[model samples]
Target chain A: MKQIFLCKDRLIFPWVRPIWVFLPLFILIMLPTWASEILSVSGFGTLGYQADNRSDVATIRDLSQRPKDGYATGPTWRLDSRLGVQIESRPDPRVDLVVQGLAYDHYKANLNNTITLAYAALRPTVNWNIRLGRLGYDAFLMADYRNVGYAYPWVRPPTEFYGWIPIFSVDGADAAYHFSGSDGIWSLKAQGGKSQVWMPINGGIGGGYHFKTDNLATLSASWQSASWRVKGAYSRFTSASDIPLLAPLQAGLAQVASANLPATSAQAADLLQHVSLEGARISYTTLGATYDDNTWLIQAEMGHTTATADIVPQGNMGYASLGRHFGAWMPFFTFSTYRPKSALNDTAYDLGATLNQGLRDPSVYMANSTRIDQHTLSVGVRWDFTPRAAFKVQLDTMRSHAPGCGLRSISPTLRTQDIHLNQLTATVDFIF
Target chain B: MRPLLTLLCCLGVCSVAMVQPTQAEVDVIVSPENPLRTVTASEVSDLYLGRTRSITEGGVSVAIRPYDMVDGLVRDAFFMNLNGMQINQVNAYWARLRFSGEVLQPSHLPDAQAMLDTVSHDHNAMGYVDATLVNDCVKILLRLGGGAHVPPSP
Candidate 1:
């Protein structure tokens, strides 16, 4: 009884403090400048509809059906969009404040109703600036500007490539100091913080563990010259495992003992298992570069991760994109891939087994552990209908492959042969 | 008599074009503090584009005050030299940074007077108005190397 209350106390209350901290800052920045400032409000949204011709590939449900090529699958996914407002104290150069709200169905499923981004920045000297409260990382390319359509050439980032490591933004504090010389210009940024997240797998044997990490850091540098510009960044994520939920896996007899309990009592017994929660380590690294001139922008990135937790499957991913701009529009294309070093375990259950028989083979109870590869091709365009706003549309074709599973009922046939999935999306993004 | 009047009108227009300010004077007016010691066209482009970030000695923040879209010289010199990115792209760049809670847009001025006010207050701020409106408040950093702007005065 005490434990449940403690979980709620530890997890639930800490997140709410930031919201309270943010609201007053918004009013404080706006209250003084209301008369002279421009209350600029803007928003963007994507009404995405996708159809899966093959049920075994990228379907939200009924993965075992393996429907025929022409089968009709209902378009099942959608997103609730986002909007923000910035109160610009125009003629006064030093201070400006922004408040934004983002809502997506997937995030909301875990009771994350309104993701708020609010902050105040003081640029005392143009070369040196410091911002505090709910700041996001200035990651390579996609990490920083996922929303603005005009900044990117593609409709959306290639999912097959980026889907491997899914942490999008960080909430923290960041500072930048700039230096310029005859040879080139250089800038540096230092940022650190923690974020609340939901992983696809739990920390135990089946998937990922539920907890937050402490070691998050990013260091970035850039040099600019007449003909070209170069930049690179490195970031790390380290998790400390202390959750009481991970213990049961180490006790062989505990599994047998739990099997004998009534279903309801078994649930209580499972909470007693905490072995896997002990000292699991996790981290990842990223690097990127970009060069652009009058006609083109070329960019690339490579990233890798090492994790002690079984939930995080470690691997490497890389991508390259090229784009060109026309008068009011631009078109571009990209190619990228994700390669997993080892497969995650697959779990299956056997109803026919005796109480002592335990679960069937590990593969039957957990996800299949095998090598997987993902390849993607994307093409898209941006149209600027107005000076401050633009619209973008992009489409991608992805193929994922695993080895040796041809079952129509038990597996995604991509294991036997490459499976194809298509995504089409349109975004209306703007700034004031 | 009619022919004479017509000739006078053509001469008036031609003289206006010829008297357009040179690139050096424009440079002095854009950023008054920085000395104009034979800077290259590339240097001018870098200053306005926000890419170079600093000047001859140190890394200085490049302040840009974008004029209304219809402002011909602002579009030609700023956007053309920066990255060939249209106004939407520039706006998007600031927006992305803004949404990320990184930085706000560089100070925006509605007209030449306001731009001059900003430039006069900060040595790092760089902007442009009519060549005829040049003043002692700000030094001309560099003249935009393009057709719309007049060449610099010797």
Candidate 2:
């Protein structure tokens, strides 16, 4: 596998490089013929400045932490700034091709995280359609357009729920069926594909990590009416990661097995395997609803994730938001929380007390490091000063009981202490 | 003297009413060739919001292509009364769908005349216009505010 160094520092596998290169070239070559009738170009972007009064680290969802460019001590533009471009060509009434690219600082630079959506759609019938290629993950209500800041009311979706799955694009095919009834429009979607997931790891010996999923499946249904929408989705994927710190632990367990300490070795192996990040099957289920009657906006989403591999914690997360429109100005409030089921316990290891302590400490630390019990409350105001643009200012205050587990930018001293952060972000979002 | 005071008050009221501009009534219109002569407010809302892509009438499915009169009181009033959403909210919804490649926004025309031309030419196209601009080429599907009525076609 070829690796691409990005963010001017990190290493990543370039799995979608070929598609990225070929798709744009194909569109450019065909642009002349389609320019007059079928080609349509559209875009949305956000320019933001954020300042946090707690830790110096700023986390963008779960992508990466901006340590070098801190949002905590001072304002940073790279934290929330992003741009996306989309090109759609519909040569026939039943067929269309869409390609979109996004540029943001997600531990990468120079458009490394581009190509968010690239798919060819076929409307076989009036009520059914199929899409093939790289499509947006539909695991949640806003999963498809989560990166488009202008689409959603919040400056950003609640990080606790939206941050769990970092992979947003799946390379595969999906089928959708639509039905219209007296109530509203209902749609059912099922997608199956694989994805390359890049998750930023903090408070670990290894500074960074990358994950890959071979089998990914998602099913979702939604009903939208004039004033209300309800949606439900479920997704499952098997993930594996490459982290350097776990190599020595694996070696130590193998050595114990060779020394004829079967009982001790078996216990150690179980502990180590449970905490490893390889070959883990993870599943996510979510239900959400939104009500927007032009004057009032109400949204709520709740999700639960279960992992077969113990390295990933089983947890539940949710958020509820309310907003009211006052002419061109809208004021909103949101409350979000994430809680893990149980802490890691390694009392079953039967090795000698000293050896057991040595092995158990690392495993317990690894498990505890992933635990997150946090709550965040946010208040914001959005001003639609123009038809195509909006200016927003938001204030967020978060408290994490699990410290480093829930909050990024965990300092050495604050790793064990409760973490509290207050952040202010102001942004201008526009579509063209 | 009482009659003179009453006459002065009437004159003052008439002048004030004359100075205030009345809001124009917006009318939703479709092509004359369309099979469905009239549309309910809910159906119009569904079509414009990308909720229902097609309308089945007389066992035939006619795909809908909704057009908008760009940036005006008529467009604002149409969306506000149809879905209770402002133009910004509607634009945001379309932006999400457009970027996700799910659906496209309605085609935007410069003014009511342009919308009239589009809806009049395409049988599947529907748009809104001021009632005064409604002509013989287009048929009124629904009336939004205070608007003149289209003469019954023979």
Candidate 3:
């Protein structure tokens, strides 16, 4: 890429950087009241650290964000540390405007992804709500509100369940209807949108990139009884942007096909077609249930995602946790697992074997990045030390049953045989 | 350093006081003009936890508002007897719902006097206060701990 300099360009709109334009606006979140009725501000944050016994691979809260390269050794604060501030304006009983800006470990350099929720909604009635803007992506049970550390019992949501979802927010609208059912209260929500998210990658593989999804539609329903809540949701989406790292490989395949080789040419073309994002589709179906009786809390969810991407395998992931409260303390245990149903196709592997070293390297990285075949056992305790804060510590021991990697970022130097890891984490979560 | 120690000591004492049971039981109350003369502890739980914002009155649905007295022994005892939930747990539950853009939280009043005043003025408002503070302006909905409270004459 090259650029030509001009005198007019230097003098016009000099402050075009994204950070400066939004810095002052974000500072206003510190003031909690603008005459109290029309405006209110609230926020949550966590001061956390993770101590790792095995550094063969790095740990990430989720694929959406990753820490710096060397932060995974011994102890690191970048994994679970985050701050989110939300400002809400309610001018009338039927209208509201909410904007939440979250600061976390981001893979992008710009401010576009920081604002998680910016929506203006119409509450025509107490039981109905419609909103159009950037809404939180409620892909799973706790995915939308996971940033609020004071809300949940564990130090964090189970990694195997929430790790694959990078969708922080979606650009679109949703309408929800709430009503009293014979058994309990029920709410149904339908949403549609287009979304784009920046994803992190190992520098050894490729630079961080952003991908877009179109025709994104989701339908979810939940019912709450006295102490039980059960919810189910299904969503479908199509990839609107190709993986940037795939461009080089696609180019290589095209070059080889153009040479008119008989067997390799057809394989190259077929593999090329399967790897495209033009019409690639993905769908997810998830179910979750929880029971909380003001003393014992139980939560579990299961989700299965099927996608057309050749590099990514379809799989099921779920976790269940049970905790009992004794005065101010809650001790819990969780078991989570992810199992892939299919592996790389024989044709793609054959092609990779015959291809040159340059093309083969990135293909391996792409395949590895999407792999998941692991289970984890975690034991944690949360102590509500104050009215608005809690202290929690967790120990996670994970083992992979196959060569495929778990949902965390892996160093290129990691060996497949070294598939066991034990990590310890502690955090103090607060809300204001 | 002395001041810091004193502050820590004060916080510890306040936390201990928050858990200790109070001798005076709180009473749930509503406006005298409001249609709801009595409600169960579970119904009050649902109202305060933000499960339902309206109650059925005279075969017609009537909107109701629930108010909370600012954090204190009254608020603490009300929650402790309502469902045995601590103030922190209740706050956490509301935080989850509030930030999720689901249900609006109960308005907070400065003190029992203010809560009584607000509820008595608004036909749709419901609140709880000290039993000894009740009067004819507000009617007793449900006595929390089976204690008898006589309303003062107008």
Candidate 2 local lDDT, A125-146, one digit each (tens): 8788898778888889888887
Chain A TM-score across all models, in listed order: 0.70, 0.89, 0.86
Model 2, span B16-124: residue lDDT tens: 3322323456678889898876667777888887777787767777787788767656777777666556777887888888887677666678897788888999998
How high is the lDDT of residue B98 in model 2?
84
TM-score of each: 0.71, 0.87, 0.86
| Poorest lDDT segment (10 consecutive residues) of candidate 2 chain B | B14-23
Which candidate number has the best DockQ? 3
Chain B TM, per prediction: 0.53, 0.75, 0.82
DockQ of 2: 0.25
Off by over 4 Å in 3: A1-33, A70-72, A203-205, A254-266, A277-279, A347-365, B1-24, B146-154
Per-candidate iRMS values, in order, are 10.0, 9.4, 2.3
Candidate ordering by TM-score (highest first)? 2, 3, 1
- RMSD, each candidate, Å? 10.1, 8.2, 5.9
Task: State in Å the error of residue B17, model 1.
Answer: 24
DockQ in order: 0.23, 0.25, 0.40
Which of the two, 2 or 3, has more TM-score?
2
